[model samples]
Target: MNTNTGDDKSFLNRLSSIVEANLSDEHFGVTELADKLRMNRSSVHRKLKSITNKSVSEFIREIRLQKAKGLLEEGSDNVSEVAYNVGFGSPSYFSKCFHDYFGYPPGEAKNHTKTESDPIELTEEGKTTKTFKQPSRMILVVIAITVLLGAYLVYQKLSGNPSEKSVIVLPFKNLSSEESTQYFADGITEDILTQLAKISDLQVVSRTSSEQFRETALSSPEIAGKMNVNFILEGSIRRQNDNVRISVQFIDARHDRHLWSENYDRQLADIFAIQSDIAKNVAKQLQTILSPEEIKQIEKLHPKNAEAYDKYLMGQYLCLKRDSISIRKGIEYFNQALEIDSTYTLAYSGLADGYYALSFTGYIDRKIGYARAYEMAEKALDMDSTLAEAYAVLGIVSKFGYWKWEEARKYFEKAIEVDPNCMVAHLYYCSFLDIVGEPDKAFEQVNRAIELEPYYHMTFRMKGIILCDEKRYEESNEALKRSYELNKESYYNYSRIFLNYLALNDEAAALEKLRELFALRPEYLEYKNDITPLYESSGINSVLKMFLDARLELGNEDDHFLIPILATKLGMQNEALTYLEKACAEKTRDIPRMIRKPELEVLYSNPRFVALVDTMNLSPYFQKLSE
Candidate 1:
């Protein structure tokens, strides 16, 4: 009995050491702990249960909760930061677990003393031998049962039938001695992600989220737990003059075991073929059968000249920065790529994206910028009709440039059909639905985009907008606040906050947000000054009138569509009808989007407004709300 007590204490001490070493790993559960201890999973479960009278999962959770409690008491970080540091992806989940374990929430831990005793005890009475007689015979029986069960499970897993597979391709490490080759490594990682995204049978985490783990010290299982994926693909790239070397490994994140690994040494021109082979091997390992169409898409090589491809990759990297200077530089690099190889379809697509971004951000003349975007997007489609990004660009042009609502919808839908994982397509379609008076659909699509790219601020902003349209003011504010937290300098997000506060009838909050917006972009000072006095003196209607008058004086065709909504808000029915008729004649895209505006509620009952809606073919989307 004394020997058994010593063995139990030794086992628990070893287990405690392992758990403490990986306290920050969220996925250090049964399988990972088993792998670390060099024991079968069932054995780990049985041993942990015998020692602590708790399941393996419960043991892991208790360790995490205890660590989090200590951190909270230290007061080094807030609840959210402490939660993530202790390997909880969500602070809310951590709070629930902490409360369940300690009978108090984590927020109270900092103010409270540590009085709760440890659950595990090393007393002689706690030994397993005390609870069961004939310990040796029982151990042999349990081992025999565990062996049979383990063999059966291993046989089933090895028979090639596995559960749903999802993977994250971590940012590839740049093994090259030159720091300048980092872009090359990033480009390769993004290319591999894009190739895998084309497979509808596979779930590939976006580069935005995976890139966060580039320098992370967390183990593969920990990362997989945070990303909620089954497999992890990580590699290193080394480029020298004209030769490139890549080393890649695939790991089953659940088991914390490597499934496959390879090394490739090839010329720079064979990079596309290398990416294709790696993707195919990963798919095979995951037991995903690729269709012929998906195979073609994965193998498609655009730029024949390696230098032009390099330039295009640089251009794409710059364009993703989404700043005016970076956009101009991206355009220059894309033009250089086109000059090197005129038939480069991706270069044209990049050019279109750059110009469209410039136009959307109001940094350039919309008419000229969107016209150039339309031309380049059409050229890209002419070169390769199957390109999902080209289709998305065409959809943007149709919606913002030509105001062809039906055409825009078709193009957006076609982009999704071509590539279901296209983030741009999903976001654009969400915007389209918002404009067409389908707030519910817009909310659904935006949520989908958020799931695919959880760290992206733009999707959160769009979600806020959809919620605002639905009049869910509190939720809208929450989403917008999240967006603001992600990007504090975003003028667009600030403006949305201002509008949301105004709609919620919080004038002081609205004015505060307005000041923040003006502080960020002083170019809007004129409009801000003009609207503030009218709002303070005569309320929102007078402010609407002032905005309508200013827009009329601006003499921009795109500014005219908003006049009808403002006029209707001020009870000027005749003026509203005239402006609405003019907007219909001009085929303004905002007219369709204004269908769900609360200010336009009065116009919905007017005969001339009904006529204008019919003329614009917007009757199908006209809201039929009950009073």
Candidate 2:
């Protein structure tokens, strides 16, 4: 049976051709190739493995590498340009892979030029086979020795840096027949991520950063390159009746090698044990020496009742959706979890998150929502002082709702101390630092948060707002644009961009962004027409007066502090002083942020403003900050 047919060769060649066509698309991997071939993923995998003894992902990477090698030989583009042209997001990763595959760095590509007649053949495992004209045995021996030396050098360089031990836990694919079980899979992934994040030695990417790859076609190596991580953890979970099966693979992304894999078949009640085991296994594999505290954190159990834990997981999942309906449902699920497990600290934190989200969405009264958030957060911390999320919720409520600056700072610092990888805590700390007039420290915290959760839109939005506060208009707009790219529907991001454009005096750009903002938040349209015409006819001053008049027309108590800023912008000194005095007297919620507004800078010289700022008791903190 001469089964190695021409058709087999054609099929393999077709796959190679397709990969070459998309050599620059980092997203073109196994699933995408399967779609292009009009076959199921498993079918494509089986056929490719049968023909070439290589997985589709491996095949694609090889094709890209071959194309990259050719590009480098041409000497037209530099290493970085060639790396990107061949679809490698990271030039360093590309160089590493090239050196490993070709036995030389990309920088020396021109020196090792090969002709069409002397094509290099790659074995099933990506080992380089002999060329058309074989070299001497002595040459082969020398080349083998060189590879061994390279491998050892790489190991030594990587082994010494435990602090560089970083990994991204990709969203586990739900293999269950019921699509509703996807949330359970997501929760398991998040649980492992949280456990890993507690370890001070490892930099675990946030769940949000990995969520985008839930159904992606990108390979582990490609994703790691994009995130600049050394490893990746991916898995699939299947739940059937009272039993569950979880299969996980840990990959050394730099080498595109599977370091370890495990398949667990257990009763549903053992889910927590599975999660804990996985986290412990990952740390052990990375050679990370876990402290006694880190070990305890990893081994901590979820709600003892499986059903209650399930409800809590569902609640956590829904809360991340961040819509009004999802938040309400999440709150209900948290309550259900509490009904079953009265002392579940995670459930309390989830409840706090839902209430805080509802407050932002205006789904509940702000005071009531914040009060509930604070109460639940306190309960969570009462049960588990190590709970970072609870402290983050408390920090946010204390700062924004109660205006307890020192208390908020303490909670935020506590949250980060308990879990250094707590991206939310870092984000809150950045905001707190900015409000306290420590812009440099604020930038540092935001950068740390971005490293932990690069895909999170809020990180960019916060940076944009902070830059706007500092009057770095161009940089502020860039950050806001990045935020907008990540989340097109975010009204707050658009608003910040509008402010940046206005500060830059790019009136046309400002108007365009304002229209987009108005489109997203239609309530602002009520006065859009009233101000647009005035802006062109009577200048920005008239526009400011009209906008302030419209704002004052609302007559809402919350609008009190904003009226002062608007009046100040319009150069109505007495009016601004009057509104500021009233706002200070009322202890308005916006008072903290209002006083920091650049528009209020003109009022800083006014004795009434100085007296009001002094009465707030912030002078000591300001003086301390200056010191």
Candidate 3:
């Protein structure tokens, strides 16, 4: 019994006794234990719920987590041994739960398995300020109840029976006549996902993983079979003017039985309260413990405007495109949201995404846009620092905005610490490391993401880019091809592979690939000139000009100066002077990229080419090499 709430003393005492005696038993669960307790099964469940604020099963999982912690602290038994001893039968399952609970690799938490060195810090500042600022009194109370419950499930997943502790949030439907308002339902679905992410006790699967169920015509048992969740939440959201209606049902997937059902209808202003109610009720139905602070987080309210939020949802839809046009459109709506409400933290996050995406594609003026990205991300953090989306935004800012790799990794790590199943944090951070030439570790993380959300095409593309950069063009091309096959509308599906094939010097293969690529998009430059880095030619200047001239029909023929610059490198002085005159009038994106191209190396000693570079404002490359 909680000392403060002595009213449920007998119940907590009963729960503690049952756990200490039979945790090592493999088949232990509510019915078996309730039978042994000599009370009605429902009565035993009721008493346990009242005292511990968790279900009989969650209480059991908590016991397992506590025991696993003891073993982790002791550093004695191997992970599998500890896992089985606690009741879990599988070693891999235990590691997954460990990651979800503590926000670290099981090996790292074990204190012996060294990953990399500690990441560099963002500042000398202590723990985040937002962790302390927001408080939801009722929500906090619910959090304590749920965390204790979830902690038990984590424990069970580690040591106890896996059958009793897992849960999955289903894709909530819109049940409305309008298909366009589906984003509202999806937003509610995602909000529930995010709220569950805060508990830290349960292994909340990411939205991408769960969204696979959106098209499912399966029953609770069938859905649970695929999701591997013991419990499931299904709901629908309806918005008609200022009135918002949400209907939800919870099921014990093991028996395909309804455990709880409720419908809520409220005004626009009551949306936050509605969210809180849904979370609290779900926690109650699952019979999980929630900590006070966590409850507060779930219940914390920001200003609500249904119309503006709808636009923000649209922004989310577009931002996920990660393309030039979609990114711009996402920002347009995000700004529209902020115009409607000054304190919309999520809108600021969307705006930050637009700026970050712009810089990522190399279309924006990096100096100013990168600065704006950091500023907006900072503002987002200030408004709601606990937001995992905001932290992920900071991760991008640290990378592109600050050019601080270590700092960016720290922010990503921090964001994942707050929400281990954060798909974007995992996906983008892995890409950052891959871009820096750490393909092995990047591959490891991207693989983890695939395991977590195998259905998402972007994850495939992200990892495929790394493979291309590593010169594993076969594997890279294959992965991108797979992603493209899955979603033909995926715009940059072959962007990386296109350059990789060229690098392999397979001209006929490249040309064949280009036909297929052109069939899908009318614009060639979108994928060729922007997304993938295309090299100059075979390691020599004169050869490079000839190479460039040979590929003139491939859309870079207008690059007049490039040919002359290459001619100067090969000692063709007259050719260099002539081409140099033509190049000065050419405007090309490749101009800024030429400094890094290897074929231009021979022209370094040529005075005319040097003068041409100076006139064309190519001093940066010379300066870069010098520095």
The most accurate candidate by TM-score is 2
Better of 1 and 3 by lDDT: 1
The lDDT for every candidate, in the order shown, is 0.68, 0.70, 0.60
| Candidates sorted by lDDT, best first | 2, 1, 3
Q: Candidate 3 lDDT, tens digit per residue, 21-67?
A: 87776556555677777776567766665555565656776677667
lDDT of 1 by residue, 1-627 (tens): 344477888888888788878877655555567789999866777776666666666666677788888888888899999888876766776776676466456887864565332121112221111110100100001111111222222232443424445778888898877655665667767777776666655567899889779899999989989988878878887767767677777788978998766567777556556545544444443333456676566546435666777777777876876665456556766777788889998899998898888766555656667778878888998988888888998898787666677899999999988777788899999988887777777887899889878978889988887887788877988998898787765555775676677678887787777666644432233456555677778887776565565445333343344566567757887987787676556545455555566657677878887887666556666654422
Worst 10 residues of 3 by lDDT: 131-140
lDDT measured at residue 226 in model 1 versus the true structure, 0 to 100: 95
> After superposing candidate 1, which stretches have Cα over 4 Å from the reference?
1-163, 175-178, 215-217, 240-243, 265-289, 506-627
Distance (Å) between predicted and true CA of 155, model 1?
17
Model 2: CA > 4 A from native: 1-160, 267-289, 360-362, 518-535, 542-567, 571-591, 605-627
lDDT of 2: 0.70
Comparing 1 and 3 on TM-score, the stronger one: 1
- Measured with C-alpha atoms, the lDDT of residue 418 in candidate 2 is 83
Best-fitting candidate, scored by lDDT:
2
* Higher-scoring candidate on lDDT, 1 or 2: 2
| lDDT digits (tens) for residues 106-184 of candidate 2 | 8878866554223233233322233222111100011111122222223433555875577888888989876667667
